[model samples]
Every structure is written in structure tokens, then in C-alpha cells.
Target chain A: MEVAAFYGFSALAILAALFILFSKNLIYGAFALLLAFLGIAALFVLAGADFLGVAQIMIYVGGILVLLMFGIMLTQRASQQDGPSRHNRVEVPITRRLWGFAIGIGIVGVLAKIIFSANFRMSGDAVSRKSTIKTIGVELMTSHLLPFEIAAILLLVALIGAAYLALNRNPAQ
Target chain B: MSAISIYHYLIVAAILFATGLAVAITKRHFVGILLGIELMLNAVNLNLVAFSRYDSDRLSGQLFALFVMVVAAAEVTVALAIVLRVYGHFKTVDPDKLDELKR
Candidate 1:
């Protein structure tokens, strides 16, 4: 049953990722990415990392994707004339897609060879790690306190900066 | 082979990374490239969480993944704001025409 669930979630994750890659509409691609994030969270559950799974869903799917969609709506003018703009730009030659494909495949091949050669044994039962939320809180306050605080400050700065930038207007108008 | 292994996770990560690379290379929209970058970051986070699960390293990788997530959020917030401003000035976020910055 667990194996079946794992494969199922994994397939969903990969399918969503492919959608994100191939989708023509930007909003549709972002939605596909949300699905990919949720599918990955499910895979995290199958791997016994429940806390990480929940965090993945909360942060990536819930938070970041919403921000992405908001940005898309704010920036993209919903007009039929602008539709040809993106299509027109697509005709210009830049880097060859085949070169990118070759490089990506080469890097994956090397990494896979190295990873598969290593004898990795799964460790202690993660299911035994009860009260993960409590432990995470304790760790955040103690051993990880510096980074925790820094992350909070970073988030605050980002929020303030984003608002300031978005609200700034040209004086020459 | 009877069950999903760590290699399965690795393969998924690899495929995600590859697709992200493709998106980064082919997409003309700046936001599309940003999405590709987010995909790559997520792939790295997946690898970190997977290793943390399979190893007895005492949640170190998991902690790092959390930090990575926070950083990615900050990055996207700042980046999207910049994209909005760029669109305001240029009226488009297409990369090829961002030649004002090009030599």
C-alpha cells in the first residue's frame, strides 16, 4: 500500500512538473507548479518527513505561488494585442535549445552515476520522531536561533522592500 | 527494486532540474525565467529533505532546507517587485528586448 502511494504521488509530481515546463500560459504554468509542490509534499509524507511535507505545502504552494500569481496579474496587461508581443519575440535566435538539453542531460548522467554507486542505507525510523512540531520549535529557539531570527528579519525586509518598490511612482509624470 | 528508493528521489530531482534548465533557456518572459529558477530551487530543497530523511544526520539537511525556503521566498518577493518596476518602465518583461542593459 505504501509503495503504491509512493509511486502514485511520484508520478503526479513528475506530471505536474512537466506541465509547468510545457504550459503556454504563464498562469497555467504557475498553477501547475502549485500542483507539483503539493505532489512533492505528498512524496515527503511517503518518505516519512511529515513536518517537511507540511512545510512544503504551506510555504511553496500556499505562499510563494500566490505571490507569483499576483505578480503575473499585476504585470501582464490582459489585452489581445499584447498576445502577439510574446510570440513575435520568440522568433529571435538566442542560445540553441539542443545545447541546453545536452548539458542538462550530461549533468544528470554524471550525478546519477555518482549517486547510484553509493551504498546508502536508510537510517532510524522517522515515524518514531514524535512531536515533530514541538521538537522543531525547541530547535528553532535554541540551536537554530540565529538563523531563525535572521530568516525573520530577512522576511520583514523583503516585505517592506516589495511594498516600497511597488508603491514608488515616477516624479516626472 | 520492490519499493521506491532514495534513487527514485534523486531521479525526480534530476528530471526537475533538467526541466528548469530548459525553461530558463527557452522562456523569453522574465517571470517565466523566475519560475524556472524557483523550480530549480525546489529541486535542491527536495534533495536536501530526502537526504535528511535517509541519513541519521540529525535533521541538519532539513534545517538547511528550511533556510533555503526562507531565502527563496525573499528572493521571489524582491524579484517580482523588480519585474513589476521593469514592466512599468519598459512596458514588457520580455528578456530579448531588455537590450538597454546589454553592451
Candidate 2:
């Protein structure tokens, strides 16, 4: 039963990811990415990483995707006529595409080989265990406090920096 | 076939990474490249969380994934702001036309 759920969620995640990749419209792609994020959060739940899953949904789907959409909306005019022309130019050299493909495939192949060869034993029964939010809180505040605080600081800085950058007015005006 | 393995996640991540590369290469819009970068970042996060699941060191991967998420958020914010400024200045977001900086 759990296995089936895992496969279901994994399939959903992969499909959403593909949509995010292939979708031509930037807004549609961001929406697709939201679906992907939700699907992966489900996968995280199936894997018993409940806290991470919830955070994934909240931060990624809820917050970041919205920010991305806002960015897209704010930067581009709404007329559909402008969208295609803005994206129509062939900027990348053909050789760069070939190089990117070669590098991506090569990296994937190498990583796959390395992962398959390693003996990955499941350490505990965490898969079956419930990852209550309480445990995550305790863990975050305890041994992982430094990183937790750092992440908070990072977020604060990001917020301030984003606001500053986005709000900057033109001096030449 | 019977179960989802780590390799399965890896494969998904690989495909995602490849597609991101494709998007980055083919898309001329600055935001399009940003979207591709987001996809790649999510791929890495997926891999990290998957391994954290199977490994004994609980929460390490999850912790790192959280950091990655925060950083990605920061990156997008700054990048989009830059994109906005670029658009304001250039009147277009196409990378090909932004070659004034190339020399």
C-alpha cells in the first residue's frame, strides 16, 4: 500500500517537473513548478520527512512561486504579442547547446553509476514512523541550531536585499 | 519496477537537470533562464531529501535542503530585481540583445 502511494506520488512529481521544463509560457511554467513542488512534498511525506514536506509546500508552492509569478507579471507587459517576440531570438550558440547537453548527460550518467554501486541500507524504520512537527522543532533547536539561525538570517537578508533591489528608482530620470 | 529506488530519484533529478539545461540554453528571456535555474535547484534539493530519507543521519539532508531553499529564494528575488532593472534600461529582456556587456 505504501509502495503504491510512493509510486503514485513519484509519478506525479516527475510529470509536474516535465511540465515545468517544457511549458512555454513563463506563468504557466511557474504554475507547473508549483504542482511539482506539491508532488515532491507528497513524496517527502511518503518518505517520512513530514516537516520538510510541509515546509516545501508552504515556502515553495505558496511563497516562492507566487513571488516568481509576481516577478514575471511585473517585468513583462501583459500583451501576448510581446511575449513571443521577446523570446524569439536565438541567443545561444549551437555549440553551447551541444556542450550543455554533453555535460548534463555526462554528469547524470556518472552520478547514476556511483549511486547504484553504493550499498544504501535503510538505517532505521523512519519510513514507517510518523515525523511529528514536534520532533522537528526539537531537532532544529538543538543540534541544528546554528544552521537554523543562519537560515533565518539568510532569509532576512534576502528579503531586505530583494526589496532594496526591486524598489530602486532610476537616477537618470 | 516493484519499488521506487534511490536511482529512481536520481534519474528524475537527472532528467530535470537536463531539461533545465535545455531551458536555459534555448530560452532567450532572462526570466526564462531564471526559471531554468529554479528547476535545477529543485532537482538538487530532491536528491538531497531522497538521500536523507535512506541514510541514517537524519535531518542532515533535510537541513541542507532547507538552506538550499532559502538560498534559492534569495537568488530568485535578486535575480528578478536585476531582470526588472535590465528591462527598464534595455526595454527588452532578451539576452541576445544585451550583448552590449559582452565586449
Candidate 3:
């Protein structure tokens, strides 16, 4: 049952990613990204990172996706052309696509071989499986305290920078 | 049936990372490339969590994943803001066409 769920969610995530890649309309790609985010969250849960799973859904699905859709809508030109030219701008040149695929495939092949051949120490005991949330929380508050505080400061600075850059549309300002 | 191994998660992450790389490189629109970046970040997070689960007894991997998620959010926020500014000036987010910087 666990294995089935893992495969199912992994397939969903990959399919959504492919849809995002192939779709001409940016809107469709954004929506597909939502699905991909959800699928990854499910994968996180399956990996026993329950807290991270919820955080993924909340931050990615709830927050970042909304921002992406808004950006898409805001930047849409009000042109009245009926052809696919508007959407086709998202497509890459054929030569670039071919090169991209070649590189992508080669990298995947190499990484897959390395990963599959390597020996990973595994704890197959079900009894040892536990939620990592508490452990993460304790570590974050103690040993990882400095980085945790730094991340908060980074978020604050980013928030301010985004607001300043977005609100001041005029370059002269 | 064998339990889902760490290798399974690693393989999935590898696939996602590859697709993300392709998307990032090939997509003309800046937002599409941003989406690809997000996918790659997720792949890294998956690997981290999987390794934390299998290799380490501590929650270091999960902790690192959380930090990655925070950074990714910040990155997307700033990136989208820049994209909006670019659209305002160039009236387009297609990276190939934003060649004013080249001159």
C-alpha cells in the first residue's frame, strides 16, 4: 500500500511537471504547477516528513502559486489577436529544445546510474519510523538556532525588497 | 512486495531535477523558468528528506529542507517582483527578447 501510494504520487508530480513543460498557455502551466506542488507534498508525507509536507502545501500551494497566478494575470497584454502567437511566445526554438532534451536525458541517465548503483544504509524496521517534526523543531531551536534566525531575517529583507520593487514601478523613482 | 526504498525517492528526485533543468533552459518566459527553479528546489528537498530518513539518525536533512523551502519562497518573491518590473519596462517576460542589457 505504501509503495503504491508513493508511485502514484510520484507519477502525478512528474506528469504535472511535463504538462507545465509542454503547455503553450502560461495559465495552464501555472495550474499544473499547483498539481505538481501537491504531488510533492504527498511525497514528503510518504517520506515521513509530515511537518515539511504541510509546510510545502501551505507555502507552495497556498502562497507561491497564488503569487505566480497573480503575476501571470497582471502581465497579460490586452491584445485582441485570435491566433496562437500570444501563447506561442512561451515555446522555445526547435534547436534549443533539441539541445535541451539531449542534455537533460544525458544528465538523468548518469544520475540514475549513480543513484541506483550506490549503497544506501537503510533501516527497514517499521518500529523505528517516526514523525520528524519534533526532532526538526528541537534542532532548529538549539543547534541550528543561528541559521534559523538568519532565515527569518532573510525573509524579512526579501519581503521589503519585493514590496519596494513592485510598488515603485517607475524606474526613475 | 518490497518497501519503497530510499533509491525510489532518489530516482524520482533525479527525474524532477532533469525535467526542471530542461524547463529552465528551454522556456522562453521568465515565469516558466521560475517554475522550473521551483521544481528543482523541490527535488533537492526530497533528496534531503530521503537521506535524513535513511542515512542519518538526526533530523538534519529535514531541518535543511525547511531552510531550503524558506529560501525558495524568498527567491520566488524577489524574482516575481523583478519579472513584474521587467514587464513594465520591456512589456514582455520572454528572456530572449530582453536583450537591452546586451547592448
Per TM-score, the best of the predicted structures is 3
Q: How would you class the docking of model 3?
A: medium
Q: Each model's interface RMSD (Å)? A: 2.9, 3.3, 2.3
For model 3, what TM-score is found for chain B? Answer: 0.92
Q: Where does model 1 exceed 4 Å of error?
A: A78-95, A121-131, B55-57
Rank ordering of all candidates by TM-score, starting from the highest: 3, 1, 2
Write the residue-wise lDDT of candidate 2 on A1-173 in tens digits.
Answer: 86778777767767776665555566777777777777778877765677778888888887778877777777764444565555333345567667756766777777677777877776653453655466557778888899888888887887888788777598876
* Colliding pairs, model 1: none
lDDT of 1 by residue, A1-173 (tens): 97788778778877887776666678777888887888788877666567878988898888889998888877765553455545323321346566656777787787788788988766554342443456566678889999999999999999999989887698986
Q: How does chain A of every candidate compare to the true chain A by TM-score?
A: 0.82, 0.80, 0.88
For candidate 1, the TM-score is 0.87
Best-matching candidate per DockQ: 3
Write down the TM-score of every candidate: 0.87, 0.83, 0.92
Write model 2 residue lDDT over B1-103, tens digit each, in one string: 2256676777777767766766677666787788778778877888887777654344677777878888888788888888888888888777788888679
lDDT of 2: 0.73
Q: Report the lDDT tens digits of candidate 3 across residue range A69-167.
A: 888887777673577666424767999899879888998999999997888665543222666767787788889999999999999999999999888
Stretches of candidate 2 exceeding 4 Å from the true structure: A77-103, A121-126, A171-173, B1-3, B55-57
TM-score of 2: 0.83
